[model samples]
Target: MSAPTATARRSRTRWFALGAVAVAGAAFVAISVSGIGDNLVYYWGPKELRAAGDKAVGATIRLGGQVAPGSIKPGDGVSNLEFDVTDGTALVHVVATGVPPQLFRDRIGVVVEGTMTRGGTFEGHRLLVSHDNKYRAPADKNVDIKTLMRSTAGLEER
Candidate 1:
């Protein structure tokens, strides 16, 4: 092939510069994301939360565990809820507002986020139920209409 024209060379050079910038930007993003884990926490179990003790007060935390059996209670205000999260080793009492998801029930896996009060209670503002990604249709005979409707009475929001 014949040598590239001057215009062609300039166009190629511009493309190379753009590629280099894109690569640099990608590398920078990768490095920044890699270091983020050290500064942020995803979740902590009840035992770990309790262990934090005095340090936990007023700290934004995501506490994860199963809902303790017999601990769900309605608070004084309407829509206020109280419950306990347990890892079978320790438990943290949680006071939250807003509706819980349909899957929320006794012994169900959950993640609650908020700050710990000075009284050793977690004041949760958000609640999440841990669920598998896969979806399956329930058998006609296995599903209970009454129970299902009760469980899904209020959809979780906020």
Candidate 2:
């Protein structure tokens, strides 16, 4: 064939470049979506957990709810804890082996990450305490703000 025209070569080059860019963009999106899917942790309350039934067995999930009143118990090990998490509608038994955070207590919100067992108990590997966003005034009746500010002024001067 005769030598290709400059315009024809430029046209082919532009199409090839566009195709490469499109392929790169598609690959980037595919990778990003897959990564997000693998790392996403769906939070489930007691009712949702119960509704999940057998489908949730052995799947890692985040259980979010309040620790049931009077359900906290000492587990087999020193750091192990057993409690029931409830959302007022349903409850799930949780067995966690770790150092519980200082805020962890019954009647308080918590999110536990672990897998649900076939027996319907959550085998928690991590524990997170959830606190309300509302702020409350301190109840120290004897301490005056002026006196406290005066005491801290010396430290600030230094």
Top candidate on lDDT is 2
Residue pairs in steric clash, candidate 1?
A: none
Query: Mind sharing the TM-score for model 2?
Result: 0.61
Clashing pairs in 2: none
Q: Which 10-residue window in model 2 sums to the lowest lDDT? A: 149-158
Q: Residue 126 of model 2: what lDDT?
A: 94
Deviation (Å) of 14 in candidate 1: 21
lDDT, candidate 1, equals: 0.77
lDDT tens digits, residues 1-158, model 1?
A: 34568778889999999999999999999778778655666787788888889898887889888788789997776467999988777889999888889878886668899999989889999999875333346866665543433211111210
> Per-residue CA lDDT of candidate 2, range 5-55, in tens?
877898999999999999999999987876864445457878888998998
Give the candidate number with the greatest TM-score.
Answer: 2
Worst 10 residues of 1 by lDDT: 149-158
lDDT of each: 0.77, 0.77
